[model samples]
Target: MTVTNTGATPARIRLAYTLPAGLSDAGTGGCAPAGGGEHRCGEWASAPGARFSTLLRVRVDGDAWKRMPLSGSVRVTATAPGAPGVVSDDEGFAVLFPPGPPVPGIRLAADAVSFDISGGSSGLEVRLGNTGRVDAEGRVEVALPAGVTVPTPPSGCTTVSPARTRCALGTLAAGRTARLRLPVTATPEAQRQAPLAGAVLGQLDPRSGPTRQVQMSFRITSAAALATPVASPPAPTGSQGVLAAEAPAVSDGGGGGSVRRTAILLIVISTLLVVFALALATTSLRRRMTAPVAGPSAAPTE
Candidate 1:
């Protein structure tokens, strides 16, 4: 509420007002509860066009559901010194009971994610969500089980321990969601099903806020475990055995197989090319050998 001094001369003033139900003065500007729900304030000095402002903190008292859709008028009258018996002014007011906004409730989205520990993983991804009416400020912390490691933490995050990571989220507004991928790696013997634990902590001691606890768990798998074994072909005998023994063995689980496959392919192609060239030479020599006395016939014709 604002009160403007529109009079020509600066003078002290007094105010008398009665608050309707659900409306309460916050005891600001020296306004005190006179008696019942009425309040009295001032003898305040003011200049022309100077304004005074105060806040009316409101709340729903008693049964607001049924009492809602109802309104009441409030009359605040101000009088200057020596202006007795003269009605200064009058206006009507409506009482409102708007429900308070919900507190910021930031929580993590603990979705189950699969990660490949056999050199197929860039990192683990963490998702977040908020369920509340206000914005929230907090940090997200992720901890991994042993054998799994964070090669590089996600943006806005840092590693507190070998297995733990924390990412600070300054303000997570309600209804806003986010996802961040944390760079990770694992050894061959790393723990499977990398358990990712997260918690959202509030900023203050419940008055402000931190993140609400939201645990995110990860499931990690290794390529060796997931890969199906391939049966090796029977060993060749005689001449083929010599070549087979010189070539590297094949494995279904590791990347070395890819390299071995290319090398074997090149060897086969080269052998085929050499055999084709030798066959052409042999055919030409056989034709020459089968040909009869061409040199004698040419000499006779000349």
Candidate 2:
């Protein structure tokens, strides 16, 4: 079947095909990598299996034909020479398509990454989620806090630091979901002030590539808390013991000083009251003597 793109704007197009009955070429084009006799696209023209392969030379309005890898359903998009947009399908088939023009670079929203820190000294585990999309290839890196250490990433992962590591996800397809757990060792002091640093999960793909890439920043927080003591402080000895023994006497002296201050205040108040009463009595006696002298003079005149 002949497939053509009549759309003015270039786009990724997909096509599906079924093989005829009773032919078994195994989809081999009679050309393969060295020491490999696997089936190629041309041989599938007569395959009698549930699926079949088709080779179509796609020539854009102004581009040449290019070879792209396809697994199940072939995905072809407007691309440049050498690197063509190729996608796989669920069924078995070899796909051939035309080369696409050099596409303007596309950008993706960096994947949003977060970390969940788990486990302890024996080892630490870093869990990742919310990764956006990386169009190209390079590395998926996670930088851990200072004290927290991660074990080597399982198999496909690489260690970038004693505490940081990465996993190879190759070309992360658009909208793909990836999860990785990194194990590390908690440093001796990690428990006190667990260092919280930012993490970067990115695609190593270069600045200039047909594929686009996105990056995400994850804010990491330390999970350590102060540990409770299993025992209490021990008692002091010798000279220290002597100082402890004098604590009661110091308290008793403070009580006695407070009592003495209260007594002094009471005594001062009593003395002031007594002086005031004496002055009042003296004033009354003078008034009485003066009144009698006046009475004696008044009586003589009468």
The segments of candidate 2 whose C-alpha lies over 4 angstroms from its true place after superposition are 1-135, 204-224, 229-232, 235-302
Clashes of each: 8, 25
lDDT of 2 by residue, 1-302 (tens): 22332222222333333321222233333323222222222222211112223454321221111111221222222221222333221122322222123222322122222223343433323322223344445456665555555555687877776756767765545444444555555554443332233344344353344433333333232343223221111311211011111112244556788788889999999999999999999999999988845444444563
Q: Which of the numbered candidates is closest to the native, going by highest TM-score?
A: 1
Off by over 4 Å in 1: 1-104, 110-118, 191-211, 228-302
Give the per-residue Cα lDDT of candidate 1 at 223: 47
lDDT of 2 at 208: 42
Cα lDDT over the full model 2 = 0.37
TM-scores for every candidate against the unseen true structure: 0.36, 0.31
**Model 1 lDDT per residue over 1-302, tens place:** 56665444354556666655555666556667776667776667776557877665544466542232223222333344444322232222333323222234544543333455345664555666666667666566665545567777756888898877788766667677667677667655342212222222223112354534533233444443333222112322211011112123445778578889999999999999999999999999999999986454444563
Best by lDDT: 1
